[model samples]
Target: MIDISRTLNADTPTWPEDEPFSYDLTASIADTGSVNIGQFTTSCHTATHIDAPFHFNNSGLTVDQLPIDLYVGRVLVVDVTTKQRITPEDLALIDLQGVRRVILKTDTWPNGAPFPTEIPELDARLGSFFHEHGVELVGVDLPSVDPLDSKTLDTHHAFEANDIHILEGVTLDGVEAGLYHLSALPLKLEGADGSPVRAILQEI
Candidate 1:
């Protein structure tokens, strides 16, 4: 299995002004005379995570309400690293038939580096396009599907409106474009907007 999730740490890049991930030992073995206990605090959107519809829409589903099968299944990984603005036309040749989950390998954010100021933009049109193709989930190597500074979050809303889910901040640096069995289940955070996932891909 190839782990595609980014490491959560103080250094893990998060959205601007969002909370950075931090971990601390709540009870040390020396003090408790038992196992060490640790605790962590982080923004739901930090690192590799899936955004529940509630992340944007007030009436949409929360993290716990999402379907588990959407995050685990046969996924098609397509390399669109050459385009800054990815659109349906760019993916015209790739066959997405029967693929419920698709991961775009932009390779723009390689090496699990700091948050990028700019990255490729996934056109909002993909929301309907993917829906038409029966795609349930869309994953991206970059932090978001829309532009980083986007205020309207058009792509995000489009996906949500079309019943397509979003998985962001994935690390697909060395993974090639092909079919793989993906397992990127999110935590059962009740009423939360999102949750970090331990995303991984196994060769099939």
Candidate 2:
């Protein structure tokens, strides 16, 4: 099995001006005379995470309400490294027939690197393209599918309009392009717009 999730640490990069991850011992063995207790606080969008529709739309489903099957199953890892803009035409050569999940390996965000100021742009049309191909889930190695400074989130809304789910901030370094069994379920966060996920892949 290969772990594709990013490690959550105090140094883990977060969105601009957003909350960074933090962890500390709330009660240690010395204080409790028992087991150590720790507590952590982090933005739901930090690290490897799945974004429920509620992330962009207040009326959309929450993280806990998402279907479990959407995150598990055969997934195709398409290597589109170095491409500044990803569009449907770039994926024309791939055999997407019957593929329900696709993980784009951008190789842009190296593990433990500082938060990127810029990354590849995902064309809004790919949303309809994926939906037409019957894809239910789309994952990316970058922090987000849309541009960092984007306020409209055109690509995000497009995917949601097409009923496609989004998984972001995955660490795809060293992972090759091919098909694998993916398991990247979100935390059962009631009413939350997003949740951190432990994304993993296994040879099929």
Candidate 3:
């Protein structure tokens, strides 16, 4: 399996002014006379993660309520590295029939070096496009499906309205565009807006 998840550490970039990832040794072996105990604190949206519909809609399903099967299945990776604003017309050439998961390889934020100030706009029209193609999960190599400064989160809501779930912050730099088996399950955090996921792709 090829790991697509980003490394989560103190340096991992998060949304501006959001809580940064932190890990601390709560108990040392010398003090506890046993193995060291560690603890961490992070934003639900940090690193590679899945956004529950609740992240944008107060009435939508939370992380735990999402179907697990959606995250583990055959996925098609499409390269759209050149476009700044991705629309259905932009992806008109790719064949999406029978594809349940689609991971767009937008080499925009290839290294996850830092939180991006801006990213390619994912047209709200994709909601209907993906729905027409039977796509249930959409993954991206950036922080969000919508514009960074967008407060309306129109694309996010559009995905939810169409029964689509989102997987964000994936690292698809060296991965080629093709078919792969994806396993990017989010944490079963009840009543939570989102959760980080250890996303991976297995050669099919």
Each model's lDDT:
0.93, 0.95, 0.93
Instruction: Point out where model 2 deviates above 4 Å.
Output: none
lDDT of 3: 0.93
lDDT of model 2, residue 202: 99
Compose the digit string of candidate 3's lDDT tens values, residues 1-204.
999999999999999867899999999999899799999999999989999998898899999999999999999999999999999998888998899999999898977576887899999999999998899999999999999999999999999989999999999979999999999988889999999999999999
Query: What local lDDT does model 1 show for residue 66?
Result: 93
lDDT score, candidate 3, position 115: 80
The whole-model C-alpha lDDT of candidate 1 against the native structure comes to: 0.93
Give one digit per residue, the lDDT tens place, for model 2 in 1-204.
999999999999999777899999999899999899999999999989999999889899999899999999999999999699999999999999999999999999999999999999999999999999999999999999999999999999999999999999999889999999999988888999999999999998
